[model samples]
Target: MAFVGMDPERIRKVAEQLRQSSHQLTMVNETVQRLINQATQAWEGQDTLDFSDAWTGQHKLTLQQCSEQLEQMSTDAIEQIAQQEKTSGITPGGPGSALKPGDVIPGTTIPMDGLTPDKLNAMSPEDREKTLEAMTPAQRAAYLASLTPEQAAGLLNGMSPEQSAGVLAMMTPAARVAALSAMPTEDRRKALEEMPEAMRDEVYGAMDREVLAQTIGHDVTLAKTESTLSVEAEAVGFKIEAMGQGEMVVNADGSSTVKLHGEFGGGRTFGSDEKGASVTAGLEAEREYQFASPEDAEKFIADLKHAATSVSIDNPNPIDDVWKVLDSGHHVDRFGGYLQAEGHAELGEFGEIAGGGRIDVLATPSEDKLEASLKLHYDASANAGDFAKFSSGGEVEVKGELEHGQLSKIELKASTNGAFGAELEGKSSSGALLTTTHEVVQGSNIGQGGEVKMTLSADNPGFSQVKEALQNGDVGKATELAYKYSDVSYRQTVNTVLADDEHSVKLGAFGVDVAKAGYHFESKAEVSTLIMEKPAGSTHYYDISGGSR
Candidate 1:
């Protein structure tokens, strides 16, 4: 029984050792299987094998044991396989190891020794250009000689004209001519022309002038054709006027001699001593004059007028007695009755005329009187529509008070507005008859009388239109209409309208039949205010009657 029990214990211990050994074998198998699986996956491009796994004790064996086993496997199995593959006559270092016929080795610099044609042919265009650029003249010449004629020509064509010419000039004459002859005609001519002038002259001298002319003609034709391809350019047009006072003379040397006599509006006038002083190469065309002030200009004009008058009076034979009267100041009263006419005032110096008061007539005599009368009418018709027409005929006596030597309390009466067909008659302060026709239209008769009187305020529309037109853009139209409707009170109303649109308008007054002809008045005004607004956008209305009577 003891022996039996001992045998059972031995069997149990053996069983336990077998179990422990089996457990260790199972762990090793599991690890090996995982490593094999990972390696297989990596070989198939699916998963990576973790070499760190063996060193980190993730496997059954210790790190030292795993490393020793791996090293042994590499030395035995891997090396044996590699040797077997090599022994089969495979090339050393694997595919792409040996250099091909045209392959360049990495990091290899080109040789700078004697450049052979074969070596140059192997270089890239850029490399060749760089090499050529770096070469000395003698070296470049030697290299160029080695190239084929076609290759040399191509290279020369690529070079700048000046550089190519320099290189060509160094060549023998025969060689240069032969090379040029091989090029296109245009290219040949360009190369020949780029040569030194003496060389070019020698070459051209060999050719006939007719041939040279033909070549030039061809070039000219080509230039014209190319020029035609360009678009037409725009031209600017301007009007120029000669504004200086002087005589212009043309000189022999295609220059101009401007002999300035006196300073005119634009340029300095040559003095009397400079009569023969000719200005060679004077201002190109017109001379411009500059005036320091309006007063200076006026004085110049006055001097000119006095000079002209003096010359006329000093003539050996005078034309009329008027000149004689003007020459002698006191003779003026003999031509007309007392110069102190009620409605008339002598302008400037009237001492020459007997019984006359000197009053500077800055304003037009006819216009001033007409405007004054019209203002009275416009004031009386303040309630009328925008469009109203007034006419008058027959004799009308004007009665007015003179305040500060100006007309006031003016009165007018006559058949007007197409009602009475008769000539309009008015009396001057001297009781002279001044006649005007009356034209009638549809409108309320605002007033009619031989002696109408009223006080006119400065705020009145009659004054406002004139003032506004003068101060604004309708200046021109205002001036024109003011003269036209010299007798109308709101004559400058058109100017007011014009001033709103056009900025510049010049005003000028013209005398009518009621006063002496050729009388003029002027003022600065804006163009906009001078236009009148009708039912349409706007219209220019001008009174035909001179703003006189």
Candidate 2:
């Protein structure tokens, strides 16, 4: 079974994406505030309020107050998100690239989600042995803690799963117990579940069964934490009740199998893994939460494929290569000059875009151009009523070529559902720009009207620095650079929304409309991720409006 679950890497990816969305929204909000302030100022300076000066000032004050509230709220929300990121152990600015396996510091929260067998195996053969000899679990944990989290993550990611486990197994039993005990319940259990049976048994025996039973689920179809015992905590949830008694079966592999059978109503078997174990229900209400089964090692490859964000992420190497590269504990954005990427989408017309986020691309060199497939998510749903959500709503796919970083040729096709919903044949080709200005002259009402000729550094950031940081997995670097290097041209649409206008409609303080046109522009810059050189199309918008009365 493959683990297409919320692993750490995936979590970081999703969070980073959301953060970007938040920032984009903030920019839109600021634009609106600017427009409101401008409109009030224009009325006071250019148009006659028709009402008393106090009336005009009141309206201006109201607008100003409203702007402040919104600005404060936005600021607070952004800060809160930052705090959450820190709490979640998300490395600032990048995919948790800084987190290392060795970061399992003694006193800090231990992170074991990234540890996999492949990572251990990839380490220098002697490295695991060296670590085992060099440090006890507490010592190792402490040593890792001494280094940066990234360094720890790096050390762990570089080793093979066995190597990593071996290191952990070497922890002085007391240190192991302390570290495991200190871990949050879910993480401790999950980490133990991922370890080799011997190592797992060591820690598992010490875990609080109540906590383990509470947090762990019974569905092992996805093989989340390899050993099926993780499911024991949820046998009932899986609809399997304990039989008269559990049986211990001796396997030819010298592994011990704890056979637990209860009534589960399904008819067919859940199928076997690369290992011969199978879970049967209905015709046989019995399932094996077997420990004697041969440990599955290549399972992670299946996981990588299952966890694939886009079809393009598949590399041009042996299946093992995926784990090997991931095991290297280094950024692997591009493999052999090819990169795989994904984005979010919207599901159910007017429904929450909760699960609709989907866009995938694989960029590869084609002669002097790039070859890629751009897939866009159109709809999605869960098992609410009749059918599963995604089964019905597929995607719009564009197979295209780009010349000199610009889209050149393309072929597009949409799923029948997508085509039907959009009223198109579900096929199309597309190619897809941004400016700003400020001026104050004559129409000035007072010599005090300050010319805020403040130049906004309009220089378009090449995005090279941020993009480079992104590729290197230095999210913190990437984010810092993104701010240091920004794209201002995109917001010019805000001008299309509204700008410094003279003599616009004014709402008199007396609630009477003064003669004049009110100026306001609802400008919006679409925020979206580009895949296959085609923008998924951003529904995010920003607008500004203001006019003097």
Candidate 3:
């Protein structure tokens, strides 16, 4: 008769052989890797490169795949033997006792639906796992999805680490993050410790940036002990307020000289006092975050890519928040800081411009405060096509604060002045110039009685007008047509709190008004708390009104 099932003993023997072969493959791979590592130190030339590439890009991968295949085969064989035993009733007095090396069992099948939480809980740990392993991924996922949170918590609490991992492996990434997030803090940490490194990284990547920030407070080991000092200064002896791009220098020897430059895009400038000359080179700027390890850096980058921010500020989230998200439920023994500066300058047709920016980031673990600041400045003058001369100068300053990895405050100051002049067809001559300044301060709290405010004003001809001006070579005409489209806004907020001995109350008032083109918007808010002395508690009240044009 044809064999319907292999002998369990024979299957076990074959599995042992597969396992041995896999072990041998691993040994060979290790030896080969050692040889490659040694050769890498002394190797040179195309032949060496070719050998290394073949070994790493093809041969090494092939060997690893083979080894994994062997191991999987061995595991499958053992599992198959167990399943057959269970199906055939292999005990001495059971139905399959009389069967030989080649035998067949009639109508043997395990019902997937027979596995329930009750059955799972009643079975021995080994049998429970075996039943779980028998289920397909779809079956496992469906079964898991059907369980209530309480049920899931109970089930997971009862499972061994391996079983728990297997259950989690069946979940989608989002579901997995949710599951972990729902777990009790200590249990979650223990579970993470029990998980495989690859699985841990996957969990980290899937977590919310803000949530991850709190979790990451544990694992990191270093913090910044000090900050670097930075200084910058600039001076102008004679500057034409409206020229936007011209600068005249009166030397100490009673001689004066004027320099004009114009350029487009981004660049940097270098000068030599001895040579009395300078050069401007076009370049692009780059930003980077420094981390203690490559793995941490990778996680930080991944979280940043997936993170979302509210429309409250122009600068990025504080560095501490980024660090916390990257940390992901790890203790940070100490904090560290990162400082970077980059500058560039380019010479345009009419004027010379140089600009650069700086970033300072520090995390104070002791005070639970994080600070970050940035500064940028630029000046340039260039011919706008054939008909216009364009010149502009601007500077930006921003400071951000985070308390315990949460944004608590921010401030921004910026100013710009520029002029656009055009002589269309060398006959229709027109020119326009504008200057702007903006300041904003936003915070969760401005101390006990602190105030917050912002002032903004701008006279932009709008982009469409600017484009038409550039195309028609009549900037002055464009301003005349669209300069009426202007914007001005002001906001002030005051917060005051009163507290003594046994009772406390707070009062707040905020107002803002904005006007642009012919439209206007205004809003106001006021709040007060009822005063209560010693025995009674204080009560607060508030009212707000939105203004209409």
lDDT of candidate 2 over 111-182, digit per residue (tens): 443433345335575764564354334334323323332333344444454554555554433235445555
Q: What is the TM-score of each candidate against the true structure?
A: 0.18, 0.16, 0.30
Among all candidates shown, the one with the greatest TM-score: 3
> Which sections of candidate 1 miss by over 4 Å?
1-130, 146-148, 202-549
lDDT against the true structure, each candidate: 0.32, 0.34, 0.43
* Candidate structures ordered by TM-score, highest first: 3, 1, 2
Give the per-residue lDDT of model 1 (tens digit) for 176-292.
544554445456555654666445433343333333322222211100000001111111211111222332222111222222221111112122211211111111222212223
Worst ten-residue run, lDDT, model 3? Answer: 532-541
Question: How far is 240's C-alpha from truth in model 3 (Å)?
Answer: 21
Give the candidate number with the greatest lDDT. Answer: 3
RMSD of each: 43.3, 31.7, 26.3
| Model with the higher TM-score, candidate 2 or 3 | 3
